[model samples]
Target chain A: MRIEVHLHPPFTQVVGTRTLPVELPDGASLLDLIERLRMDYPNLFPSLRSPEREEEVRSFAIFVGGGEVLPLSYKLREGEVIEIYPPLSGGVVPKLVQKTRRLIC
Target chain B: MNAGYMGKVLFVDLTRRKTWTEPLSEAWARRFIGGSGLGARYLVELSDPGVDPLGPENPLIFMNGPWTATPIPLSGRHEVVAKSPLTGIYGEADAGGHWGTALKKAGYDGVIILGASEEPVYLWIHEEGVEIRDASHLWGLDTYVVDETLRAETAKTAVTCAIGPAGENLVKIAAVMHDGRDARPAARCGLGAVMGAKKLKAIVAMGNRRPPIHDRDGLMASIKAAVPEIKRLAESLSKYGTSGRMTTIEALGDLPIRNWVQGAWKEGAERISGQRMAETILKKQYFCGACVIGCGRDVEITQGPYAGVQGAGPEYEALACLGALTVVDDLEALAYATELCNRLGLDVISTGGVIAFAIECAERGLLPAKVDGIELRWGSPEVVLALIKQIAHRQGLGALLAEGVRKASEDIGGLALEFAIHAKGLELPAHDPRAYNSLAVGYATSNRGACHLQGFSYIFERAVTLPELGYPEIQDRFGVEGKGRFVAVTQDLMCLFDSLKTCKFILFGGIKPTHLLAWFNLVNGWGWDLDRFMEAGERIFNLKRLYNVACGISRKDDTIAPRILTQRRGEGGAATNLPPFGEILSQYYEHRGWSPEGIPTEETVRRLGLEEEAGKLRAKAVMKV
Candidate 1:
């Protein structure tokens, strides 16, 4: 089977990639794939594993595609594109700031 | 007729113990407006061509722009200008809080502080008058305490700008923290040290007089029209906070890791991002005066190792430099270090960079006999925290590091100094200029050393578009093409914002060029249009450049350190991307109409109405020599 991944404002850089076969024993978790990806991308996983304090690793978030995913074991189909977008910033730019008045009001 | 302005310039000479207010002249306001322009005009007049930055001759002026306290979005801001200890040139840092508003309320347009105080004191401004209060007891306290004690003791919630231990110690990178809690820093140019050297603890202002408005009804209606556009942008900010950028910055490989060793932080960036904060630690939110967007995150550490240790919490830069850059993942440690900088009255960016540089030096075996066996190991959160305390007090190895990155690197010696990412003696902020090419120029040519806010090219490079007003499409972040054009345009715009004392976020919020024009027209009753406003911005930029030129900095000096220019991030999204500094700088020189060596050309001087002053300056130079 195959999967499609979505990129925002998608144009430049890598569009998508074909991943390894998704044949897991019975009901392997999504975390299993992430664990696999962790092995695949060591640099990406560097911050996640605190060599000094293992407990600090708990702060990270994993997003599949664009939104939150089910637990890691929530298995993925063969071609599903998994986006392990780590603890990305939300309110990314605009938040509690001075505002312009509403035109309608 | 000064219609919308306070119509006076308040002058305070601490050395002579004299205070006076000068009625505003029509020409000055018409040309310079407020904030950066007024700041530059004032600084140019006060500073000698070759005056020592640390000497008493430096003038620290605080200014507000036309839109400052008006009903415009993010207008609660002001500027501080002095000859910078960091840059050995013109120094300026703009801050946002209620202080700018209070200055207006006190029936003054701007305040120029010159000379030095004989003893430790603070200036108190109420609606009625100004008083020099004894600040002997408040002298050694941290900014938090100074702010709290002033409010408690004086019965006034006066917005205060106070120097911490670093400033009092005359650290070159010391910052003047405004309002105390927001960390709304006038955090560049080492202006805080100027405050400290004056033996001044703080300036507390709370006044009730309203600034006269020309088109009050029209302005109010315009302001009403702006409120919703503001709310839409601010709503996200209030929810996410500024730290919300950590993970994304980390993801983009923009986060500075290990003194800019890598683009991505190894210490899980997402873990410290806003989502994690909201889920794990965030408690309440905070805001400045009339500020709709409250990016201040109040956090509570619970159920973790750092649990129960509570403070305002660590922002992104701290998390980057102290955390990932130092290889420390303890959020508690990051928060503690940030609080320590606040306590010690230090610039967090400079302080963090200092520690990171020290770590690199220590790892490189540059620690000498003076280090007293202190381990400068990278990523050692405990030691990093301890050193932060030490730097504040200038104790042991901390004493050496407290001298800032340049002197510290000089003392440490070896290849370690090469890795020190500094421009104009001040350590660069958390952003790796190497990753963001335009930032290289920003860091190099900033009025204050190594400031990101001064140029703010990152916002443009990172998909922020203001295309409705016809800004060119932000070039590729990794590309150096059109960067000079980008930097020149952005620098002028920043000058405008800095002078206007408006939040940088206002640009992102679609405040429109027309809004600023209207505000300017309303305040000074100047018939100035948008082109004139932009020209004022350009004039201020060149004026600041002239100050640097007078201080003897040349094109040769406008450059990033070897490491930032040559080294590429070893890992992360920005791997293999190095700033095309030389190319961009050449373009920048061309854009500014400067000589290849960075001197302002005669043509530019004439075009900008600086030709008359240029002749006078040349005549003065010959006379002095």
Candidate 2:
């Protein structure tokens, strides 16, 4: 089965594209699709397992078909659209000051 | 003496043209923990509950917390407390800028203004003393103009908090403007209207004194420990600022769209996202005092219908209210509207909310088709901009809107209140409670009305967790279960943050309670542990709730708009969730140790050592004898 994968914001910055088509086997679960994508694009996504928890954790949110949250166990049908979001942190600030040349500079 | 405080509270009586300084009580500081907590205490003791919020008898207090003016990350904040002209209850708003730091350096822990000035005046606090100066020339100016005028008139290094024309005209949604160039606004609860009512235009403070830090080395160590994670998070925020998260928030069904008329607007969300601002209009990123995350934006619209519009860009709330809520996809126009709000000293959330409410009313023919020859319609940028001026100037239809959605709808009549979308008189911010169940209770019980910062339960529901407090990183956002207890606990935690004058952004960076406790001990030499600090937080929360109860707020006031409680997204991620508000409110009241009417039981009141304060409420006839 063929499904389209869309990335939002900084994820698009990392992946260099907003939308992409992925070839998946019919009846593949959402986690299976994620695993396949992880193998294909190793550096694009953060790990689902948290370093602190030593178990699976959700760093980014996933939405299916017009911003609906579906479980990873849900089966993926052909031509369905899935959007993968990047890990969002707090509102604006920076760490150490680079007095000479900052990020904006 | 504790290390982190100036131990002086300044009192300025505008009516008498007099100023006095009183040494702060150590016992009071220990119990209140400064900032909003201390400010609330002063308001309770000094002002009457039945006093008109816009009257001179109501005192406006500015307070700094123990962490303020220190090198602690995100600590350059102050709380503005007053009897809310909008909510007619306990009101507080926090702002980040250099003004708070300047005030702290000028040898003051807090300032209380009482009585109205017969003529316009501004207070100048220098090394020697504070002087009430004539502000007749600065009257009728915009916020930025007032800021610039004050800086020019005072020393160049002086930081000023000024009111714009909206405040001067007593617009109910007016917000106090802080910082000059970037223009940070303490834009909540209509405190600006309170200031305007006092005929106070600006407060300029400049000094070189710093609060004595008891353990500088320990404070440095605490900050160093949190720096790396803070830097990483800050970098992410610097890329997009607050507006960049529009798409993600929209995806969660948390972003308000078309004034809560629709569920999803993917294309519109993208058009107004922070990424779009960075690529198109952003000239530079703005940062508050000592903020490493620098989530503020400075944008310039060089060309477009809004060409030459240049100033602070839209934050998430502004983007949601001015852009998405009205379906105005033209980013430049929305940016211009945001600039106008800052200039007029208007709260963007309330401005957007009131305008959206007005548009919804006009669509239903409840309002005139054209007000002063300006047609009212969704996506009409001119009308939005025009109405902002109107609200600030109290002109035409803007006069009605300046009173806020609750009053505006009441005046408009005919099913308008059904869609006004406010908890009390204050308009709702951008977040939809239906997306996160805790937010529903947070909004209903917020002392200053429908406010997000009061609890920020959404952050707990989605992004972060307090593992030390046993709250998992993420709670079930759509579920109604466990929300009441969660809201109550988090409200206390956030109240502590507010009292400390620390920015809530640090919580997202995984700052723990231990870190906060360490800062308090090191700076103030209080030696408070986590439990003790949290108890103070709870005490502060309950005290503010008691203040509201004194103002005649009760269980009936702990309610959300009927539209939010009854309506569902019907599609999208928030679908099928109508927010069981009644159940959540009941649980919240019980968890808060309040009676079913949302009044603190005598047992709970005495346990928090607020029995005297509660008794005062009864003495003032704000409570039943």
Candidate 3:
């Protein structure tokens, strides 16, 4: 099955596209799609997951089908469109600061 | 004299035509800090609870924090405080520009305007002198004209904070505008009406004096260490300004659409977004004094109906309120409307809110089909522009709408109340409470009535975390548990920001309580730890709450609009979830150590060193009974 993904800024800048179509299994969960994206764009994963707790995907809010926040375990349907929004308050500060220090130093 | 402060406040009695300078009480300065906190302390000391907000006795305060005129980033801001004509409760508005810096440079920490003038007048403060000049000719002029005229009359470098015809007409939703076309407005609580009631037109400040810094070297080192990261983190914000978040907020169902009834307006959101603005009319970015993040937009409409519209561009609130909320997707028209609001000294949030409310009222036959021969319709740019004029001039339907949604809803009667979205008379900002659960509680308990900046706890739920506040990791925004404590903690921290006159956006750059405290200590030569800093914030928050209590604000008044509370968007990111308001509010009260009636308890007040404020509240309560 093919799923459509909408990426808002920083993510768009990262992924080099506003929208992307990816092929996934019919029974793929939201987490599975996230893993797929992580595999596809390794740089995007760091932003999507919490910096303090990497296992937690609390950094970005993922919405599907009319803007409902679904659980990561929720199954994705064929032709479903997923919208990923970067944190409205900006990115994770600690990691960004570390990265910024690395660049500055 | 304390370091980092001007050490004195100028008091002007318009009726007596007398000016005096009072030493800023060192004890009170330590207790309240400055800006909103210090202003609140002075307001309570000066005025009674039941005084009419627009009356001669209700003092209007323009206050600067210790950080003003300092080299600290995002320190170029000030607070305007008065009893609100709109809410009849504790009121304040914050603005970032050069005015606060100018005022500090003019050798005053704040200015307290007392009594109503028999005629129009303006204050010219330069260096160590203040002259109250006749502004009779400046009357009825727009803010732009007043700003320019005052600058011309004073020094060319003078920064003018002025009110336009909306304020002159005593519009309840009027704003005190600054920087003219590069508009920065302390645009809430209708304090501009208070200025108008005093018959004071503009305040022009010009000076070269910088507030004395205790340890300039240390403060500069700390700032230097933080500048690179602050700038890097704020890159997107610098590029797109605040409107950059439009699409993201829309995606989260946080954007108020169609008077906050609709769940989604994706295409419309994209069209008016900062990204769209950058690709269109966005000419440059505007920065405040000592600002690292330039989130202010400067745009020009060169070849459109809004061709003449230029200068400060519409921000996220303006775009959401004037564009998405009204279902008007025309970015250019929204830009024009924003400029119009600025020129007329009208609060953009309230202007958009009243316009939206009027349209909804008209839809339900609560209003006439046409007001002033112009049809009232949603998504009509011409109608929106015409209504803005009418509101500022108090012409026709504009007069009723200018009273703000709370009064206008009551006047309309019937189902009109159903659509009037406000918390305690003040209209809600662009952010919807349903999208962020913390906002529901924050809006209810906020002292200034439904202000996002007052609490700003939603930022924690979204992106940031305060390890010092016991949140080492981002908590579940959807979860109801512990949100009460979360909001209380964040609100206290936000109070510190407001008092310090620092932008809350510094949180995005990973600024912690320690950093804030370090800056405070470095500037004032005080060794306050995290606990002391947080306590000061708690004291400030409770002080404002005590003031509100004196004004008869209780648990009954601490609530969002019924529609916002009960109605579900039923689609989009926030679909089908009403905030569990009761449980969250109970936890909030428990955390705040307030009684169920939402009044600060004697023990809590005593603990925070607010015994005097509590005693005043008790006195007011006794007088009422």
Candidate 4:
């Protein structure tokens, strides 16, 4: 089965493309696809999964076709399109200041 | 003396041209916790329930909370409360900018203005005192010019909260603009019209005083420990501001499109998104005073047809309302329109709602093909821009729209109310109830009408979790179980946020009830536990509801538009969910301890120590009977 993945920034920056195609076994769970992406894109995996807690996915939201937020156990089928977004925090000072602090520290 | 308060409230009578200072009541502060809560308490005591909102009897209040102007992150906000000319009920609005901080520094916790000035005037508040000066020249000016001219005439460091032609003309959708070009607005409930009716042009605050702190070192240490995590959690917001969530919001079916009749507008959503703004006209990020997450955008359109359209870029609400709701996909044009609304001191959400409502009326032939010499068509940038000016100046068809959607639709008559899209007279914010089941109940029971911020229960349904409120994980947006209890709890929590004048975005930074309690205790030297803190919130919410009940609001009035309740998008993320609204509302009433008619029960009033308010309600009920 083939699945289409749409990534928003900063994931797009990490993966170097907004959309990508992946092949998966029939009746594959959503977690299986995440595992596949983790192995395929090592640099992007850190953002998808927590660095400190490997088993825990980061707070980034994932929506299936028509914006349904299904669980990881949900089965994926042929021609499924998945959209991923960064955490919607809705403000600016904290991020820029944090980035600067990271560089300094 | 309270450590975090100035312990003084300034009372000005415009009719008598008299100003007096009264000691802030410690008992009232303890019960209300300042800002909206305190303002509401004062309003209930000082004015009757059914006073004309634009008349001299209505009190216009500007209030700050304990956290305001302190070193606490996201504490630079204030609340404006009045009898709404738009809703005719408990009306309040919140804004973030330096104006609140400046007011705090000027050595007052709040200002209450009564009576109307016979002539145009502006109040200059400084370290010395307040002076009611002539502002005849400042009349009829845009907010930008008023701000600049006020600062130039006063201290350069002073900040001004002013109204423009929209407010001057008594436009019901007018906003009270703060920080000049940065343009933070207490932009709902038609409070600006109240300010205009007072013939008060601007409030300029400049001073060097600071409130005494109870535990400065402890507060600083806690803030330092919390800052790193907050910054990390809110990094995306800092990068893209609030408009960053446009694509995701659209994907989730939360974005209102084509006056909320359309299910999806994928390509159109992307064009007006924050990412698109960053890629195009975003010049820099703007920040309110003491904000750790500066989720404000500063944009400059230096070279387009929108050249000279600079400062205070549109946020998520503006983008959705002015862009998607109208089906206007032109980003540059929308940016210009947003700027124009700010200049004219209009509420973008209400302005967009009225314009979108007018377009639908025209499409159905309920209105003439051309209004005020401009063709009324959806997606026409010129129409949107022209309508904004018309509404602000109250000229032509703009005169009707200036009354806001509810009244305008009533005047238009016949099936127009079906498209009015408001709750208790105030236009709905950009978020649709279909997207989140909780929003339906949240909007309906909100004391100040269909305000998302009043509850913000949708945040828990989307990203954040409130472990303190028993949600260790995100609640199911489509689930019906326990949602009534959930909405009630979150509304109480949000009341604390508003009363404290802290930005709600702190929740996105992982700030919990415990953190908020700790900060409150530290700042005020109060030994309040989590339960006690939450009880205060409940008391505040109930008091406001009691005020509304006195104003003749009942369970029948606690409703949203019929269109929103009955219609489904039928094709998006929220397509099939209609929100079992009746069930949720029943559960909400039970959780809130209110009667089936949505009135606070006698037992509830006793529990919350609101017998005084309940007495008022009983008196009114007896009079009616």
Candidate 5:
């Protein structure tokens, strides 16, 4: 299955493309797509996961079906456009910036 | 003299042309803690509740905090408090710029203006003394021109806060702007109308001396501890300015769309975002005095219709109210509107709000087809720009809009009141209550009438935390539980911040209550623990509530637009939520120790040392005991 990903700023600059089509295996969850992106772009998602349990991750607010979704266990349909936002959601940049410092440490 | 305060307040009686300096007592400083608290203390003592807010009897008080003009980052702020001409309640607006610092340096803790001037005049404050000068010439100029002309006449280094024609015209949504093009407005509360009614043109402040600090080393340590996080926050802010998070706000459905009638405007958000501004018209970043996070924008449209349109902001609030709410995706036009508001000294939030309300009325044929011959419609950038000027000048249909949404809607009658989004007569700022459940309660209960900054629980609702305030963990913005307590706690915290004249952005830098207490102690030499600091905040909050009670505002006044309470968004994070406002408001009353009617209990007042205010408020009978 193929998913359409719309990258927002900073992430857009990081990925070098505004819109990218990524190929994913069938039955892949939203977390699967995030994990693959994190693997490919190591620097981008340094603080993307919960420290206590690395498998548990926070994805960019997923905007699909004309609304935002948590994307965890959210099954994707064919031709679904997912906006994988940076952890920077709504003026929450300060928190994310602080989180980045902790992750680096 | 206290270590932090200049220990003197300047009193100017405009009618008699008398200027005198009175020593500010140490006990007063300890009790009120300056800025909003001190200003309100003065206002309550001097002005009567029934006094017209635009009348000569209403005193305009300017106050600075202990941290103001110090090495403390984000301390260059001042509060303007008066009986609001707009809301008719406790009205206070905080502004960032050099004026507050300069005023403090000029050997005064605050300035209280009593009686309106018979002629247009400007107040000049220097280290030498205070002078009430003839300013008949400066009365009609734009704020930028007044700033320039005053700086050229008074010392070049002097900082000035002035009102433009909107203020002079007595437009209820007018603002008192500071520092010209890098304008910082004490725009809330419609204080500019009060200033205009006073016949004051501008205030010029220049002083070289810094206020004394009790423990410089200790304060430095606190600042140093907070610097790393401050630097990180500043980096992001400087890169994108305040609207840096525009896309995220839109995605989260926090931004108001189409006059709060519709939601889901990602394309509009993208066009007016900070990223787009930075990519296109952003000329440079600007900063307030002693500010670490330079979230201010200086932009000019280099090409297109709004070419050479240069000014300060289109902040996230402006972008939402002027852009998304009006459905005008033209960023340049929005920027031009921002520039116009700054120049004319109008509050962008209220101005945009009033204009959006008018657009909605026009669509329904409630408004005249041609407002001074200009068509009113949604996404009509040209009409929006023209309406702003007409409002400032108070010309024709603009005169009705100048009275603000509540009055305008009342005049228009019929269905207009249903969509007139205001509380207690003051217009709401950009953030939508639907996005964050806590805001619904916060907005309804805010002392200063639908102000977001009065109790910015939305920040905490999103992700911010303060363990000292008892919330160790972040709460869900969508959840309904615990929000009543959340609004109560955050309102108290914000009251302290407002009293201190500290920037709310400092919260983003991870500064906690401990750091703030430490700095206050070091600066003022008054050693107070966290509990005591919080006690003062509680007292101040109650004091303002008491002030409102005296003004006849009761539980009935703590409300929002009907549409917000009933309407659900079609799409977005808050798609299904039509804020449980009443339920949360009841919970808030419980946490606040207030009666279900929203009057502070005797026990609560006694605990916070607000017995005097409690007694007065009880006598009013407006506060249910």
Candidate 6:
């Protein structure tokens, strides 16, 4: 199976041109693909080990096609395009409340 | 109870050119709390059901909450409310930094401007008194320059909230800017236009009076306790700033793209994320008044043809809307557009939406080929920048754009109105609601229209958990049944924070839902139960609702944009799900004790102690029609 990855902003330079092919054992999942990629592009992606994050579980978000990619147990087919992304916060600082901390420098 | 507190509301009747001071009672402050609640109460007293937003009858109030100037993390915030020129509903805006604190220190809780100014002028407040000064020279200046001039003239260190050229021209989406150094905008709901419509340029305050606290020892102790959490805030926010979350919002499929006609910009979304921001222009971090969490970004675009200088950030939502959502991936250009809005005094979110809607219309051949010497195209940062300038200056192409998405569509005469992407004339923020059903209610019921802070159930709805509270789980982000319950609970919790004037970021630390109750227990010594806390929130929410109803909003108004109800994301979290907004709204109505039409029911009015007010508003609304 061959998969392509897309990155945003300045990271577009890190989006590799090489289409790495993986020999999957039957119905290997996205986690498996990520594990394989971890070996190849160790530094390009964010890992579950967030020194700042207090949670115990290795947390990350993945999406394939148009929906949020579920847990690793889900199976993947050949030649499907998957987009991996990370989480961000802070929206809405109602002026009446000014709850949002977002500001210009 | 010290002499330091203003304990009064200063009134400026621009229409009559009269001024008066209304006493602030301990009882009133105790019951209504402050900030949004106080402003809502005053607005209810000031507006008639059918009052024109731009008319002299509409009142603009700049008010601060009780906890505004204290050492609380991300505290020191204030609110502005009026009949919104943009939405024709309730207009509002809020800000932090020296402004709110200075207002309190200047010996006033808030300034209530009762009528239109007869000429261009600005309000200057010192320890002595509040005065209206000629502002004809300052009227057209950008907010930054206005702040500088005001500071220079005041000959003191007072902060300012000033309007720019767009506001001066009465652009419907104008913003009121604060913090001359960092440039914080109370930038939604067109209050700046109100300021502009009245020919008011800025409110400058410089005073030595400190805000009074009932218990200094207790306040000092609380501040000390919150310090640890505040310290940690600097690390998380200072590192990436709020733009840091763009990648995360993109990952969750929450980022709005292509005028919300699409969920993700498969072509260019990632190019504007926080990691991307850091790799490029990010320089120094900025702070609000005493805020340990310096979420403000200082960046310099020292690359390409647009090299050299920097400004504070044009931050998160603006970056998403003006940068990624419109498919305008050029960081420098979007940053420039953000700068233009600051200079022009417009809301960047609405600007982005209006411009994107235009581009979409132009792409669909809805706009005429003869539009202002150029074709508007998606992903073309130049066109976006051109429109921002046009909209700000209200030039030929900009004149139509100045009317905002709704009016622009009407003028252009196309199916463009269908893609305007607003709720009740207010543009939705950069977040896409298709990914989270809770946002449907948040956007629908937002008093100012399509706002996020009113009910920030996003954190609760997402993977971030308050485990001890036993949440409904992140997998249920799209679920409908329990949303009303979640919305109500979060609304109250947020109200308590808004009342206390605490920063929302404090929630990430140990300040859970019950923390407000604990604070009340320790301070003010109110031994109120959780039921009382929740009831206060319900009352405040209901009061705001009644205020809206007084201004002519009804069940017909609280609704989601058609795009969220009918569309599905082809590349993110909501791929297969089209939100049943009507169904969720039905539940929200039930939870809010409102009728199916989204009006507070008679039974609910009585229960919330608002039967008389509701009746009067209902009658007024009917009579207006």
Best candidate (score: TM-score): 4
Candidate 3, residues B1-625, lDDT tens digits: the string is: 7898989999999999999999999999899999999999989888887889999999999999999889988899999999999998989999998999999998999999999998999999988699999999999998888888888888888999999999999999999998888999999999999999999999999888898888887788778878876765556677788888888788777889889899988889988988889989999999888888889999999996779988999999999988887899999999999999999999999999999999888888899888878888888998889999999999999899989999999998999988889999999999888888999989989998888988888777666678768987656667798999999999999999999998988776567676787789889988777898999999999999988888888888888998888999877778877888999999999999999999888889989999886776667642341
Candidate 2 chain B, which ten residues in sequence have the lowest lDDT sum? B228-237
TM-score, cand. 5 vs. native: 0.92
Q: lDDT per residue, candidate 4, B1-625, as tens digits?
A: 6988999999999999999999999999999999999999999878888789999999999999999999999999999999999998989999998999999999999999999998999999998999999999999999999999999999899999999899999999899999999999999998889999999999999888888888787778778878876776666778788888888778788889999899888788888888888888999999898999899999988886889998999998988888888999888898899999999999999999999999999999999989868999989999999999999999999999999999999999999989999999989998989999999999999999998999999888876677667987677998899999999999999999999999998877767777788788778888788898999999999999988888888899989999899999877778877888999999999999999999888899899999976676557541231
**For candidate 5 chain B, which ten residues in a row score worst on lDDT?**
B616-625
Candidates 3 and 4 compared by TM-score, better number: 4
How does chain A of candidate 6 score by TM-score against the true chain A? 0.52
Per-model TM values vs. the true structure? 0.84, 0.93, 0.93, 0.95, 0.92, 0.86
Better of 1 and 3 by lDDT: 3
Model 2 Cα lDDT, one tens digit per residue, B397-421: 9999999999888998889989998
Model 4 misplaced stretches (Cα beyond 4 Å): A23-61, A72-79, A90-105, B616-625
Candidate 2 — which residues are off by over 4 angstroms?
A1-3, A22-80, A90-105, B623-625
Give the count of colliding residue pairs in each prediction: 36, 11, 2, 10, 0, 17
Q: List each candidate's DockQ score.
A: 0.07, 0.19, 0.28, 0.22, 0.17, 0.14
In candidate 5, what are the lDDT values of residues B398-502, reduced to their tens digit? 899998999999999999999999989988888888888888788888889998887888776654566667876456777788789888878888888888878
Ranking by DockQ: 3, 4, 2, 5, 6, 1
Please give the ranking of all candidate structures by lDDT, highest first, separated by commas. Answer: 4, 3, 2, 5, 6, 1
Comparing to the true complex, what docking class would candidate 6 get?
incorrect
Please tell me which model should have the higher lDDT, number 1 or number 4.
Answer: 4
Model 3 sits at an interface RMSD, in angstroms, of 5.9
Name the top lDDT candidate: 4
Cα lDDT, model 5, residue B572: 74
Winner by DockQ: 3
Model 1 / residue B66 / CA error / Å = 1.9
Q: Candidate order by TM-score, highest to lowest?
A: 4, 2, 3, 5, 6, 1
Tens-digit per-residue lDDT, A16-55, candidate 3: 9989998998898887888888889887745344333321
lDDT, candidate 3, equals: 0.86
What are the chain A TM-scores of the candidates, in order?
0.44, 0.68, 0.71, 0.69, 0.66, 0.52
Candidate 3 segments exceeding 4 Å error? A1-3, A8-18, A23-80, A92-105, B620-625
